[model samples]
Target: MRLAFNNFISIYQGLSREIWVLSVVSLINRIGAMVIPFLSIYLADAKGFTLAEIGWVMSSFGVGSLIGSWLGGKLTDKFGFYPIIIFSLFTSGIGLILLKELDTFYEICGGFFLVTLFTDILRPPIFVAIRQYSSEKNRTKSITLIRLAINLGFSAGPATGGLLIATWGYTSLFWVDGVSCILALLIFVLAIQPKKKIVEENDDSLEENKKSQSPYRDFPYLLFILSMVFFGVIFMQYFSTVPLFYKEVHELNEAVIGLLLSSNGFVIFLLEMPLIHWVEKQKKYSTMQIMMSSIVLVLLSYILLIVGHDLWVLFIGMMLLTLGEMLMFPLSNAEAMSRASGKYQGDYMALYTIAFSISHLVGHNLGMQSVNIFGYNYTWTFMIAGLLLCIVLLQLFQFSKKREELSQTAK
Candidate 1:
């Protein structure tokens, strides 16, 4: 127990200022920004819309998120991080307020698109900017804290939103979320100043003033983006498809569904850091490799849900799924940050976020349609198989083909 306590203490000591600020921002964003804007409940309870209409509304959010993620990266590059972050938070607050007043479907859709756009737009900039304060030596720990903070916020935020909706109604949730976002903006405005690149004694003079290149011109960043698509599909399902699965098949009550969702956070808070050390310990057990393996496992949760329809079993399955997700967040983040060019860190991270956002926006319904049209079993089987195939490809694909081509030419 003492040894374990000491290990955790040392880990905490290693955390950088950037990671700390990110965690605080993430905590506020999750808790405050989601307090209102209940898509399904509002559509059903307030508007008397059908399940299909709600799906469309949710899709609007996805569409907005995809565009926002791409734009956030570019905006960060053009305007710099602090300005873009502040501007997006303010813009998103307006979008939330629009949700409070808008009633008609078209108007609501417009608000949804804008709100989704600005809300998700803030994410990649937050992620990329954190890298300025960290190096390769500590990047994994930095990402781990960021993920933990996000989950921490989610753990508290939705419950608060639920309570606000219960007592005051849906609009209250929006106000709280918006206010929370503003609070994060204030904190960021006060504390974080951008780092300076001061010249060092041993640094090369020729390289000092060299023109900065964007990650779009960097091939390795692009390659990592391609690898992320498979992983994104697995992550997108939780927000997009899993709810329908639980409703249609598991027949879980609202409380159980809440537990299942929160369990994802619980798993990460409990397991991810411990597992981080194990993954880092072996040369072959890279953070990326572990993340790839975990994503395949996450896909398998759908399989068990489809096969058995048992609540306890599904809960256990999701624990495993969360375990997989826990791996991806830190591992892939570290991998991407390492690969980015210094001049284009914001743009690169934003582009990376775009891949995740597009997968959610474009692919969420596609995957959900599987469970809706085909039986649950078929859907789970197909998605899980696809994820496993991705894991295999990620492991074998990175550098082998390029080296093989060169060797063939030499022969």
Candidate 2:
């Protein structure tokens, strides 16, 4: 037990003070992430919207997210991290408040779009800050710590949202979620030091800068983005399609659905850090190798849900899904960071954020349509097959990289 405890402690040994502060910020923000989790259920159960309507409303969030991520990346590069993070949080809070009063289809869609835009705009800047604040050695661990805080907050959010929804109705979620963002902004202001804006560039230097920072210029990184989109679409189903499935098929209430959602967080909190530490100790797998294997677990998770109708199967699937997330997310983040230097970290990470945001844009709308038109089994099967294709791509990427290295050596 002592040995195991020490091993666990080792995972956190060298992360910077700033990283912990950022993690705290993330924790606060995510704790109030009640609205998105329950949005579909609210629209369906409370407002009597059809599945197609719910899907489109959710996709509006993704559309906003897509624009926000792109703009936030460019803005963060031109300005710095602090202002963007602060503004994103504060405005997102206001957006959430505004969302509560929006009941009609168009009204809610527009409101939700603004809410998601402001919220997601923060992602790239936070990642840029993470890279700035951490050492290369602890980069992956830093991302994991932030995600750990997120999952910890996620564990609390749904559990609390469930109770609030049960007792107070859906609007309570918006209020709490809004308050959480404001709280996170306050914590961030107090904890972190001000970062100076990047030095202004001359016209020639600006042109050079644009060329260097453009994500389109990097082929391999673009390939990485493609893989992430697939992974994200599959993973994000937990938010969109999965909850609706539980509620519709099983006739579970908000509280139970929340518990089921919280299970993902519980699994991550208990096992992710310790497992990552152990894997690092083994030193047998590359980041890509770990991530690729993790995708397979994601496939298995969907398979479990498709094959089994028992509640226990839901728990089992969530465990597998969370485990895959634990492996893939942090490693993939580290991989993204590895591809960039300090000069264009914001742009690179922004591109990375786009993949995640776009997945939601595509996933929610597409997954919902699939579930509504086809059955749940068909949706899961399609996702499973998509993951399989991702695995093959990852393998091919690794193989090509190896061949390129050999060719360089021969020269």
- Among the numbered candidates, top TM-score falls to 1
Model 1 residue 32 distance off true place after TM-score fit, in angstroms = 1.1
**Each prediction's whole-model lDDT (CA):** 0.73, 0.83
Least accurate stretch of 10 residues (summed lDDT) in model 1?
A: 198-207
Clashes of each: 4, 0
lDDT (10s digit) by residue, model 1, range 278-357 = 56666966565576677767876766766755778888778777887777778877777655544565777877787787
Residue-by-residue lDDT tens digits, candidate 2, 1-411:
999788768778888888999999999898899776788899999888999999788778778989889878877877778899999999999888778888899988898888888898899899988878877767788888899998888778877999999999888888889998999999899989875643322334333443465666755567788889988988889888989988888788998897888777777888887777666666677778889889988898899888878888888888888888899998888888666544566788889889988886788778989998998989999999999988876777667556645654565
Q: Judged by lDDT, which candidate is best?
A: 2
Each model's TM-score? 0.86, 0.83
User: Candidate 1, clashing residue pairs?
Assistant: 32-177, 35-173, 36-173, 36-174
